[model samples]
Target: MKAAPPKATFAICGVTLLSFALLSATDRFADAAVLGGFIPARLSGLAVPYALPVWLTPLSATLLHGGLLHLGFNLLMLYFCGRDDEVALGRPGVVLLYVLGAYGAAAAHYAVGPHSTSPMVGASGAISALVGAYAILYGQRRPSKFSPEVARWLHIARLAAAWIAVQLMLGLVSRTQGLAIAWAAHVGGFLVGLIIARPLLRWRYRKA
Candidate 1:
């Protein structure tokens, strides 16, 4: 029998599509982002924005993207990694990992850029979590398609360093252009995924 589709993957994609459509179809993009995007100051009670509640922003913000490239990149990563996770870890487990990653990302962004007023939005942070999970799941082999096998930890470390360096460069460029990029959030999400992936995998598979 054809198995049922992965719920987490479909749900995430649906929400992202709906968000992009609604936000782009009207003039409410900025307003929606402001209302839904994570603002650490608001969440931490250091400041409050009247437009939206602080607690929900972290999750809501995951549904947002800065542009088509941003959305496409996140969706591609989510499709590849999220489906694999759902198959390996079960629907609930994958969803929980994603949510936890989002929260972790928010926490890190809050820590590093607490005073900034710009709202942080996008699924890269959560997607980075999936990348981390992927690393843990398949780290025994060489990560890059073009490379030979290496030590698992070394592969993960190299990938993490490269990810951080690229994100930092992009963040710097964006900031210089009056844009904000929550690259720190990406690091946090990746860490969360890396830390939890093995335990989650063992727990899920051991029972199956």
Candidate 2:
């Protein structure tokens, strides 16, 4: 059957296309690390004092994955989180949330990380934000009545909380080893989603 028109989001296909394009560029074009960002590239393009400077790298970096497993895992999560969200928020809202989350990730890195002119890259922050957005917006849902038949998978809050713990733990591990991990970014982005999710959902409801 032909798909019914998307209920909330606009240009849903476009967002998916762009995301795939980023994957191709980083995976195919540069042949660099795919899932994560690089120190050198993160530093280039756009600067402002004490602000989360938007850069082109975050755009592509969010799609690039480090390895097959890395990309695959994130893609699975994104499929669950992003597809629904894009459908809910439409293109503009999707873009806004993604950018905000990405920037939040970068800002956290800059704030806590020791002054290394390293380029930061990765979609974990943004994707994590998407994860966060899903958690917060879904906010304490019982499994739908059909849950036993189909949706009986997971609780939204539980998944989001678990993910947060994992990110924080990973960051601590990185810190202990003196390795460069942008754990702070994940925290920041996740928090951004948490803080604003209810409002966004309310707005969407009102808009509808």
Candidate 3:
């Protein structure tokens, strides 16, 4: 049988592309980032003219990107992981993961730097959730010396550590190059994915 189309993934990518194109064309990248991106300080009563509500910024931030390269990388990840996840989780499950991931990432960022004024933009945090789900859904399980429960938790712990290390390294590299990377958001989003993957899978096939 032919594979099902990943309509939700395509729709997300298309919207993100259009948003970046419009912002770039109008030279409104900064404007959009301020108005739409998640600003941790905003949660603490920082005021801006016509800015999106603090609660909504997390979702809106996913629609904005710093540059073509930023947008491209996120879209690529979304396409690969999102498509495969859609097959297992179905469209609603995938969408739930992405949305929750964005909020989870924002929460983590705020917890770490609540007073930060920097605007966090890009779908990477949200996509990190998808990447986490992909890793769990498709990762090979190794025979373990420990009991099943202990082994499962250990596997999760290992994956989480690896992801955190990678994000930390990326953060260091970006900092050296005078670019900001939301490594905390990535870790937070990935953890959310890992936590939800099994539940969502069971939910998807509950009747089966």
Candidate 4:
């Protein structure tokens, strides 16, 4: 008989890409917070195919980041928060979460800072959304940390929720004084990821 297909892991390529992105960001921003200097830039949503104009830094800045400290934490978060979604949603679902989460983040940042040069670059926006969806899916279940069942990871659910609420609230309140927090991106990405992940989760729970 043919073997069953392998299940997906949390974070998946998001973690890896984030890892390398952090490395690049670190190499470039070791001295100062050079936001969008590194990482992938989107040219024109559909024009660049997947990259942005370097001059349009702060616009899609979250796509970039700096330092292992930043990257490591983000990737780690993605791993934990991303698991349930990946396991339940499958690899393709994971990809959808990442992509949609990215769009959510980028959309928020772009809308907030259409004319700013702050440069929003990082995986937090996307990861936060994955965390959001994961939290919503399994927030009330699991052990709130480690679970013997791979399908019921709890620690991630808690952290993801906390992170999303904290970031969004902070960014919104702080933005009034010209202080940006990328909260919009977090909220937008998370909501999008959560919506996209819903059906995938349902599909995974079907009885044989």
RMSD of 1: 3.5
Among all windows of 10 consecutive residues in model 3, the one with the lowest summed lDDT is: 170-179
RMSD of candidate 4 to the truth, in angstroms, is: 8.0
Q: Which stretches of candidate 4 lie over 4 Å from their true place?
A: 1-26, 29-63, 142-161, 165-180, 202-208
RMSD of 2: 7.4
Candidate 4, residues 1-208, lDDT tens digits: the string is 6423424443354545654666565664422234333222233332222334554443334444444455566666777766656766767777667767777776776676555545466667777677767766665553435444543435444565678666556556545634456666776777776566677677666663
Summarize candidate 3's per-residue lDDT along 1-208 as a digit string, tens digits. Answer: 8779999999998999999888888988888889999999998989989998889999999998776566676788889989999999999999999999999999988999999999988787898899889878876468878886777667766766775676566555555534488878988898889889989999999999
TM-score preference between candidates 1 and 2, better one: 1
lDDT string, candidate 1, 56-103, tens digits:
788889987767666776788788888878877778888888999998
Model 1: residue 51 alpha-carbon error in angstroms: 3.2
Selected candidate, larger lDDT, 1 vs 4: 1
- Candidate number achieving the greatest lDDT relative to the actual structure: 3
Question: Tens-digit lDDT track for model 2 on 48-152?
Answer: 333233355555556544344334545566667766666566555666777788777777776775354555555667777777777765544564765442442
What's the lDDT for residue 166 in model 2? 64
Compared to the true structure, candidate 4 yields what TM-score? Answer: 0.60
lDDT of each: 0.80, 0.58, 0.85, 0.58
For model 2 the local lDDT of residue 176 reads: 51
